[model samples]
Target: MKQKMIDVSIHLFDKKGFTETSIQEIVDELGVTKGTFYYYFTNKQELLTTIHLNFIEFLLKKQEEILQDEAKDSREKLRAMIYMVLQSINERKKSARIFFREMRNLGPKYLEQNVEKRDQFRKNLQQLVEEGIHKGEFQEDLHADMVTRGILGMTNWSYYWYNPEGDVSAEELTDIYVEILLNGINKSD
Candidate 1:
């Protein structure tokens, strides 16, 4: 039931702008009463908040799984994180779009709360960059926070244009991104 609501929110928000999607529209689509909607969410904003928090929580949990895998070395961990992101985007692709792209209508209060989760994701990436640099796998002077933003900027931007019907599989896409991440644009020996 919770997942159903999340799905409805994603579909409705994607098809229509967040500011334009009303609770009645969602209720009508779900064939549920206003009271039913209220039970799961106080209002549209609350439902949006739930969706945002759930996505961030899901991402953090998966990241924990990859980062805590001691069987892998630092570079492997970094690669795993990148792969995990692609996998997550593939699985939760629609919800991710709603969580990331549609949350501005959530107002500053809710958005501020959600920012903590965003910051945690950044911190996780920053730590990985720092670790990679420590091991001489990445630029030693790599600005961990800056690199974190760069990696996120590159990966998250895919949501705007990534296609399930596209030529590259998600794994292939992850590999492509990783190669560029590790080797960068400069030619090497």
Candidate 2:
């Protein structure tokens, strides 16, 4: 029942802005009474917070798993992380859209927790970049912080325009991004 409300709310929040979506709409979509929603979530903002947490937590867990793998180099881990996000776009497109687009609607307490998780994701990636540089896998002169942000900007923006069902598979897009990151597009004469 709780999951049903969340799934319905995600669709509603995606189609209608978070501020524009009402509790009644969610319950009506689920064909349940408002009491059922209140039983699981205190209010709409709490539900949104849960949605945000669920998305980021899944990402954090995947990142942690990739980071812990001993066989993969930093470059391989980076590719895995990128592919994980892109694949999520394929599997959870509506959730991704809502996660990115509806963030501003979160209340202060909710926003704080969400921002903390987001920061953790960025910091973890930055650490990966720093590790790559230390191991000579990446350029020594590169700015780890900037590189992390660049990776995130390149991937996260895809929710707005990337077509998971289009000609480019997530694996192919991952390859393209990894190629661009590891080797720039300039032609060498």
Candidate 3:
């Protein structure tokens, strides 16, 4: 029941902005009573916070798994991370959209919690960049933190425009992004 509410809420939230979505709408969509919602969640904001926390926590766990793999190099780890996010866009499109778009709706306490997880995810990417630089896979002169941000910025923004059913596959998009990150798009005449 809790998961059902979350799934329906994610769809509604993705379609209608968080501020625009009412508890009545969510329960009506599920054909449940408001009491049902109150039984699980204290209020709509709590529901939103749960969605935010679950999304970031899930991503963080996946990221940690990718980073912990011993056989893959830093480049492979980076590619895997990009693919993970892109794949999420394909598999959990509504959830991803809500996660990115409605995050600001969370109150201060929830906002702080999600921010920490977000920062940890970014720091993991930064460390990966630093590792790549240390191993000479990436350019040494580049700022690791800035490059990390660039990689994240490019991939994260895909949720806004990427169509899972489009001609481009997630694997293909991952390749393009990884290539652009490692080797710029400039022609080397």
What TM-score goes with each of the models? 0.92, 0.97, 0.95
Model 2 agreement with the true structure over 9-30: per-residue lDDT tens digits: 8888889879999899899888
**Model 1, 59-97: lDDT tens per residue?**
999898888888987778878888788777767777788
Quick one: ranking by TM-score, best first? Answer: 2, 3, 1
Alpha-carbon local distance difference test for all models: 0.83, 0.90, 0.89
What local lDDT score does residue 94 receive in model 2, on the 0 to 100 scale? 86
| Clashing residue pairs for model 3 | none
Best by TM-score: 2
Model 2 misplaced regions, further than 4 Å: none
Using lDDT as the yardstick, the better of models 2 and 3 is 2
What tens-digit string does per-residue lDDT give for candidate 3 at 1-189?
999999999988888889999999999999999999999999998999898888888888999999999999999999999999888766777878888888888888678988899899999989988998899988889888888888889988998899868999999999999898878899999
Clashes of each: 0, 0, 0
Ten contiguous residues with the weakest lDDT in model 1: 86-95
Error of 3 at 82 (Å): 1.1
Model 1 spans > 4 angstroms off: none
Q: What ranking of all candidate models by lDDT puts the best one first?
A: 2, 3, 1
